[model samples]
Target chain A: MTDARDGAGTAAPPSAREAYRDLLPALMRADDRLYCLDSDTGLFDRAAFAGVPDRYLNLGIAEHNLMGTAAGLAASGKIPFVTTMATFATTRALEAVKIDIAYPALPVRIVATHGGLAAGHLGPTHHALEDLAIMRMLPGFTVVVPGDARQAGEAVRQSVGLPGPVYIRLGRSATPDLDARAAGTGPSAGEPFEIGRAQWLRPPGDVALIAGGPHPVLAALRAADLLAAHGVRAAVLNLHTLRPLDADAVVAAAAGTAGVVTVEEHWRSGGLGGAVAETLAERAPARVARIGMPAAFAERVGGQDDLLGWYGITSGAIVAAALNLISGTPGGGTDDPDLSRV
Target chain B: MAGRAPGAPGDPPAADLPAVAHRVREHIVGMCAGPEGGHLGGSMSLVEILTVLYFAVMRIDPRRPAAPDRDILVLSKGHGAICLYAVLAERGFFPVAELAGYARPGGRLMGHPVRAVPGVEMPTGSLGHGLALTNGFALARRDRRCFTVLGDGELQEGSVWEAAMASAALGLGNLTAVVDRNALQITGPTEDAIGLEPLADRWRAFGWTVREVDGHDLGALHRALTQAETDGAPEAGRAGRERPVVVIARTVKGRGLPSVEGKVRGHYARLSERQAERSLAVLRARRRRAAP
Candidate 1:
């Protein structure tokens, strides 16, 4: 596992797909029971699986069968890593995943790509905005959204021994590597990443910016920088694991702060924002300003970054939301419906 | 009775099949009489299929249901879970007395078959997933055989066809699917809901070896299943005949009980105490008339 970051520390890291292509082959080779099942994703190179050709299978463009077959393999003592687009894996094959995998609590890892607005140019038909909510609701499911390529590899490696179904949401484009050591605060600042534990990228301050996925986490870091310029100290938390959430970290982050602001590349109602708010509502009361895609579908199509900016999921939007919460503004806590118009 | 433990290796004598099937049917009828009732029609239709698989066909051990190399049987049409429970109990997977607590509170047996039940390969109340699951089992260990019984009505799901295509494409010769072709679902006749005519041809088109048989005939079912198991063997693979097999078992819904036989109402019913006794009487009369 070579570091994707370069000496300059500004090199664009590999996308989640590239990380899987580099990581899965070795993982499969080390564990004979691990099989890779693809629904014609065409992401991994055939040469990479040359050693384990028999274990790698492309089930064609059938997500339903892909999931069901993975469940069957899991039940038979083989761990199957299923790969497909997020939309198809969640919506198209939802029933199969629920009944065949989640209901039985099988050990099938669904590493879905092009999550959220990653497939923005392909239009709404390809976007997977609702996948997190759907997968999180399934009983015995572990939902993890890796903030970068490195975390994606870690997620795939850690999920191999998990006893139940796991859903790993990934993106289609490259994202900057998120190194907590750069922030130089929190006890876990330099510790290795662990699933279900939040990574504190900055010291606790007046407000905490909580987010998951590649762009949102990076945006949260940038928002923390922007908040520093405004003389308001802000903490950035990479809440990669949605299920089995790090509620303790969330509650602690909200203890002395004005409130917490959540950012994600998904719908405002679910995903990281909903998970944060739901945890805080019961454990600790805090004002939350959720910055994400609105309830309506994308009215205009663009690249991943363009769509994120248009939907108010950028660092600037996060700064605005944090400032509003600090000032005790009433309507700033919820999603801004007017952002969808742009 | 054969002097061997239940689910012991080797097939029981052919003469014993009818008696075993008869007892299984009795168990189903009795269980359905419980307050919740069971999927009477589908369960009754599956009596011979389950009996033949558990008794004369598959390689399974009641004492070691999870043996690494043992054959697998998934009741894909999980509404017919009662038939599987009855057959498993009779085969010594569990005590037959446990059948009484089925669908009752605190009972391990639910309306759908789950892994909690012994000898059930996978929980499959949802239609259209069994074939794909069997494909997985077959692919995981090509040496062992895997089987699943799907309802004829379950063919309406597009996922079934998706699995059908995959089974053939993967050349999973160690896999066999038996369709309980009772030709009816809860809504009405399968044809009325969605016609699956030329069913055998459809399976053949999906690259499978199709064998249509009378589901009630123990001899035919036994033969079809045996041939399927043999055909799936790697050594039995001919030059161009390495294909998965589907045994279409044509059966009548609610076969033994004359009142609900071949009727829509037989799909599900809560039998009164009198109704249960009457149904058992009809089954006994049929057995007596068939005897020498």
Candidate 2:
């Protein structure tokens, strides 16, 4: 019933995992019925919930029952946070997620960890590449893949208030906390974490870099800095929440900027790139590039960095895509086949 | 039409259930005689169970079905929705007029229970999910009882076992599940279709406190349910075992109207006008015999 999360020796920056472990117990105190259910993915500390053991039910390996139990708790007037790896939460328990949680509009927060290439060492079978696409198909489902652990914790805290099913995709890696600082690049970054709103780390310039998930957002910021050195002023918009998408920002970025490029660790077909492209195609058609893995299973990469590199979900890929769009040569080698019409 | 919110429902006249069930069966037969016939056998088999719960057992307020302290019921065997609808209307959850819209499009009443229907606690059509869901409801407000009626065939779903395991492990004594053990499924006899013998032992093995009862015997259903709600005292006893109850309600597929009684074809059929008249006449005869 335990995993590698309990054996961590990293002094990594306070992650969303840390924030949730610290803040969730407090939320539980505020609402007695705010129970925590895990699929035996002991990624978080159980001792942290020292006082309320009954409030925490480890559903072992049954992902379907984990979600269905959450729905039952919701129906019974308890707010339950169902946790599991992103792989099981979306695909393995899809029917439960759809019928039990989403269809009923239950107030259950799905705090899924190891999303996308974040589980890189675990290979494609563990990668939740299609989570966002699958979740978007459910009506009234709020999907958020925060840029960092801080945003993730903040999103989780905010999700408790929303009265419907909310899917919060967390990463295995605990990157530095998100800083909404005022001094950085294109746009100001100090936006409070909101469920439906998008946060911009840097403002729009010659081109805008729209990305989500922990690694991809950081990569886009790094790409923006690299684009600046090459005289291509690029902006980074952190689309933390996938559904109830910030279409207006996408449209504005398209209308104001020369071009736009999307980055994510997910497949190029239905990730942030697909969401942005679909929005832009209808609202404002513009030159765009999508930097992501092809519409296929990920390679058997050794580690997270290697997996990101193999799929071209790196800062270099984002910079290259932005530069291609900034110049007149859009749809460079970075464009996905799914984006041919876009 | 305004739904009359009456006082919390009280026990029925102990002697009147047979006649009451007879009338309820007549209503079921009339509704199924139309083009939109329902799962008549499943619903008919459950008439006494629903009658016992609504009239004598459950602490429900039809006027305010959402009362925080009221007992909740989920019909996991969704095919038998017409029977539930009939019981709910008789219990005054909605007006009798709503019965006409059963199985019709753009109406509140449907083949399966939706939250749109006032009395239904959770939407259930796909089997094996009800027990798990009801367990949550029980755990949330352990002070009240959460009951779910499931079909014998629904046990074939792994999700049923999933809920069964959780409910037992958690010792959710505030919850109870009534299995309509008619033995036959939509395809054929459940054992013939998918062997499920040793059913009682399987539930006990899963950690549930199991009980068997004559499902059509209204007095027996009333006794079993009354005993279930009295356990697991409160949240203060969370540390102790709060055993959830599962009542195996033995029944015949078609409980009355002998022409199709216990026959698989009664599962769903559009009764002809003549057949419907004869069925009503038979139920009325049973009513007269039970009345005096």
Candidate that would win on DockQ:
1
Name the runs in model 1 displaced over 4 angstroms. Answer: A1-11, A180-186, A332-336, A339-341, B1-15, B228-241
Q: List DockQ for all candidates.
A: 0.78, 0.62
Instruction: Give lDDT tens digits, candidate 1, residues B1-292.
Output: 1112244433342348788788888888888999799899999999999989988878887778888889988888989999898888778788777888889998898889878888888888888889988888888898988999999999998999999899888988888999999999999999999999999989877888888999999999989988633344344334554688899999999989989989999999899999898888888899999974
**TM-score for each candidate, following the candidate numbering:** 0.94, 0.90
Q: Write the per-residue lDDT of candidate 2 for residues A131-155, one digit (tens) a residue.
A: 8888877898989888776777788
Pull out the clashing pairs in model 2: A16-A149, A186-A203, A187-A202, A187-A203, B5-B63, B171-B242, B173-B242
Candidate 1: residue A262 Cα off by (Å)? 0.7
Instruction: Report, for every candidate in turn, its global Cα lDDT versus the true structure.
Output: 0.85, 0.78
Error of 2 at A19 (Å): 2.2
lDDT of 2 by residue, B1-292 (tens): 1122122343233346665576678778877876688788998999998888877777887878888889888888988888888778777777766786777778978778888888888888888778778877887787888889999999899888888888877878888899999999988999998888799888877767777899988878888888744334334233567777889999999888787788888999788888888888887777677665
